[model samples]
Target chain A: MPDLGLSVLLKGKNMARLLGGLWVALRISLIAVAISLPLGILLGVLMAGKNRVVKAILRVYLEFIRIMPQMVLLFLGFFGTTRAFGWNISAELAAIIVFTLWGTAEMSDLVRGAIISIPRHQYESSQALGLNKRQTYFYIILPQAARRLIPLSINLITRMIKTTSLVLMIGVVEVLKVAQQIIEANRMTSPNAAFGLYLTVFVLYFLACWPISLLARYLEKKWR
Target chain B: MAVKILAETLLSIRHIAKRFGDNTVLDDLSLDVHKGEVIVVVGPSGCGKSTLLRCINALEPIQAGEILLDGEPIKPDGKNITELRQKVGMVFQSYDLFPHLSVLDNIVLAPRKVQKRAKAEAEAEALTLLERVGLKDKAASYPRELSGGQKQRVAIVRALCMHPEMLLFDEVTAALDPEMVREVLDVILKLATQGRTMLIVTHEMQFARAIADRVIFLDGGNILENTPPEIFFTNPQTERARQFLNMFEFAAVKHHAPAED
Candidate 1:
């Protein structure tokens, strides 16, 4: 890493710490997406409730997330409500909580749209096949709907990664915030290192997001 | 008249009426199916022919009238509806084969999941059904890879693997290619040879005449005529039936000329 102009950042052991920060960001994102997908499915299905009040509540909740800025959500999670409510939540925990809520809602709506878009006859066929409601969803409808959902879910994971940047506002020391701190510390020694350093952060984001984008396309083709 | 048998009704639909918003379908329709009887419901498109079939299995909720299957009532959210539907397997005009499953899984799914059969036993039964449908070699192939006729045959076997006492065909050949239609008809003819009871909704009069013990003509959501095939084709009772027959004949003739030309 030091052979190129990267040597300045790669001196002694700073590279390892910077990489450790990147790994932490990656770890948070991976856990967030894993937790959010199934949560989203649960919420999306709850939104499909037959009762008017339940449906109305779900609609309000989903629209609330959709309309509000994600940074405001981070603020609400980290600073505004938790302290006021007297809860001792960590910044990392708040960041994860906020992103999970946001990712799950969006993914759930995608699931809802995909499941409902299936020809109504698919459910009728399952009924005719003698499958009970649980069996129908577990076996027929989910398997079919899943084919349409893989790409969308992958896209959601990538969105989760990009949105984690908003967590920097919540004081989560993820990649971008760490990069900003490192550039500030080295501002005197490496005069133009800020742009190059930020470029590394950009590259890290690309490295994380590009493969996911490719995987989404690959899944769409494989399933289609 | 040993085969004349006691007339046992397998299904009794008494004056069922269904509506989709302002569109009234299946208006005051009453019908009965004797055990082991094959009835074909034929009519022009938009006459609610498919909806009537769905009503029998309680796939669509009926606004009025009652349906009794095997002496048990079928009502909305009724406890016994799932078991009744299990006894009634339906094949769609588009084949509706689960594209994801192989021909084998398609057959084995209901038996293993609904009937709670052992996987090994289900596999054995699926193999036999695949052989019966002449799809033994295609068992491992997906529906997308199969021709239309083969897919429909696989669908029939899938329905039969559920061990339904009666099977419903909602124009299974309509989406099939012209060359493939007869291949599917041949499978239907073979099923008839084994005396399997089926209620078919088809536009193919020749298949209807050959297999249906009796044919019921539906038009404007009403039973215009119900009689033996010879009588129904030779002498339709209502003006609507006559008009339907003429149109069907015109369609057949129109379809036949292109092939010849």
Candidate 2:
């Protein structure tokens, strides 16, 4: 039989620390997403542009960012920048920067797909109506594309929330970091504390992400 | 009836040539459309009938030649293109109604956005046009909910809301069912009675004969014949036109002949 004591989480200051860590994680992810989404949409629109040289440059950037792992990127921003450029950066800042870069690239690709998926006739009809390029995009294309982009972008947000766990490697005192600390502190007193704390973290993450996934489903059905 | 040449020419296509990579679609084609003239262009598929219409609307850029609208040369890409496009409206074969917008919104989009008309004014005008087409009840319905003929009627009303000087119809009834084609054709006939200047590209030989002031037969990227419909149908000048008419006659016979014993 395993020790099922809830005392570790209920102890003074422990719950507060865990909640504080969760707040950090949430802040970092939300800030990253807020910074990334508009930039990503712009990049995505540019990706569909006709200029070859601009497209080539954006292609290289997108591929390089996408091909590299998030953990590797986090390390590069945190340790590599400090060593190479002699810059001092906080772990939370580094995590936010890395995630912003990653999120922008992913969101841009989604936007590109959504824009391209619009029927050719839509563009032709708009042009024939004498609508300028700006009017066409704002009135016709973007409205149609938004219906496709919302759900996929919501999925990206959830993924970003889950991926924030890797921020612990950079020494960000996030939810995962706090959970590890609690387990380590109670390792001798309660042999099963690791499992309990980890289960609690898992539940917290599920609670955070469940509503977003449900929103994605609801939007998809509504749009359809 | 004789070919009607009223007033001055409103649109002039002079020595226009268009090519798609290696395929030459329009080979130095030149024609003049008189004011209030209902010009019907007929040819076999891939003969550039639709391309000619697209060129007039500046949808396809010409390789070499100038298009003059009302004595002013039209540029393919320029600040003036939008203003020129306001005078030239096009209704496509697929109807091309915006699926995201309701019928009323679809008809009012250009007037509200491009013409900068107030929303209430545009909606009022749209409602009048909708009533004209007998689609007033479908004003709030989506394109997907309407039948094909209804959608095409809304498309015509959408183009008409611009009050264009010239309307281009590219095989407008080609996508409709046999029963549905007549209703769409009837709408075009009504437009003709109202003296709307139109350039229609269609396969409906009977409809062409009924409304066309002049007919132009295109063959192999060139206008082989331009004459009155009665002449072209009864006495084609070129072998190609005669052959084309014979095929139509044969198809018509096969269509209406008694069942084989």
Candidate 3:
């Protein structure tokens, strides 16, 4: 094994910088997930509700999110809104905002699916027991929906973590951005630096998402 | 006699019509149920027997007509329906016990939450009701853990825990195995002996004959025959009821013929 560009990681403070970058990506995704969970659940319940108007409005919102690409959303959120509205939102802030919005839309759809997936008898039974609408949701609906939501939501977390890599385009200094910088700085010294650096980035992402994916799979099986 | 008549009428359905979209499920149906009376409504599939019970419980809204339980109209909305449902218990054929809850929890959920009873008191009452249903040992078991008859018993206990003025059982044994059907029907028979007012929709003619003080033969969403169980079983008034009872008799004979062989 000649030089496979393994020495690049050994460069002074390079690995530490890459670790910091990974933390940045993790931080953004975690915050986005935290904010999205409750809001998504609320929106999802509304989407699955009886109100035709609310259903139509949320349908349009969901379709809009699903049709548009996330990168375009990032550009629109970070660059378009910043320039048009004249707000001074940081790149990190923009990434968080865009990711949260996307996560919420996706998560809410999952919630709606989970809510409606419950058998109609569940609602009727709860009603027959004289449970009010609120109590029906709190005691009967939510508890059951939650089991379905957990494994799916865990999958969303992994998707969200992977998607956070796109924030590098918006000038957020996450793992991929840091990886690019390291590769660019070592372009002349390490002839195969691009291959190795990109490969390491792949490993980092896999490491980050693997456990979450495993967790999702575990829960899906356990619950089923 | 007038005062007794007025006092005995527990539920009164006055010319009710229920429609699902364009199809009419119950067309201009009227009925009266007395206190401590076990009224069994039997009819062909889609004759609106279950729909009638559902409408009385306010599970389905009536397009036309009024249902009064103890002199108060049971509307499908507002604060009154909750109180109404508390007094009028309905058990489905599917035995819809909450899968997430244990037998005791499923029974006590309404009493503790809606009635605002203490946890200890509600749980104790639930255990007692479970015991009455021969399910005291299974109080801690989840619905999925029990057999069909066991689940149906738990459901009956759940309804009994509410201490309703009456119970509506919509073919409670329809989904059970042949072995399981007897257990559930036995529970209902026990309830009937206690003079618990009930409206039961069932295809089990034997059970209908055994438990019902009055047998209501419904056809085309109309009450064709309303008489004592003896009269209805032996001397049905309508051609439709006579044919319906004959069909059951034929099936019952065929059912036991193989056993005799």
Per-model clash counts, in order, read 1, 0, 0
Residue A5, model 3: Cα distance from true site in angstroms: 3.1
Q: What DockQ does every candidate get? A: 0.63, 0.65, 0.61
Candidate 2 lDDT tens digits, B33-112: 88888999999889999989888888888898889888777666867898888889999999999988999989899998
DockQ, model 3, C-alpha based = 0.61
Model 1 regions lying over 4 Å from their true place = A1-5, A82-88, A206-224, B1-7, B251-261
Q: Chain B alone, TM-score of each model?
A: 0.92, 0.93, 0.93
Clashing pairs in 2: none
Q: Model 1: how far is A30 from its true place, Å?
A: 3.1
Q: Model 2 over residues A103-199: C-alpha lDDT tens digits?
A: 9999989998999998888988888888888898999998889888988899899999999999999999899999899988888887787877888
Worst 10 residues of 3 chain B by lDDT: B252-261
The digit string of per-residue lDDT tens for model 1 on A1-224 reads 43223545775565666677677677777888989899888877776647778778878888998888989988888898776997779888887887787888898898888778777777777788888888978887778788888877887898788777777787888878777777777777776667776778788889988988888788777766
Worst 10 residues of 3 chain A by lDDT: A215-224
Worst 10 residues of 2 chain A by lDDT: A1-10
User: Could you tell me how far off, in angstroms, the CA of residue B219 lies in candidate 3 after the best superposition?
Assistant: 1.0
**Model 1 TM-score (2 dp):** 0.90
Query: In model 1, what lDDT does residue B159 have?
Result: 87
1 versus 3: better TM-score goes to: 3
lDDT over C-alpha atoms for residue B7 of model 1: 64
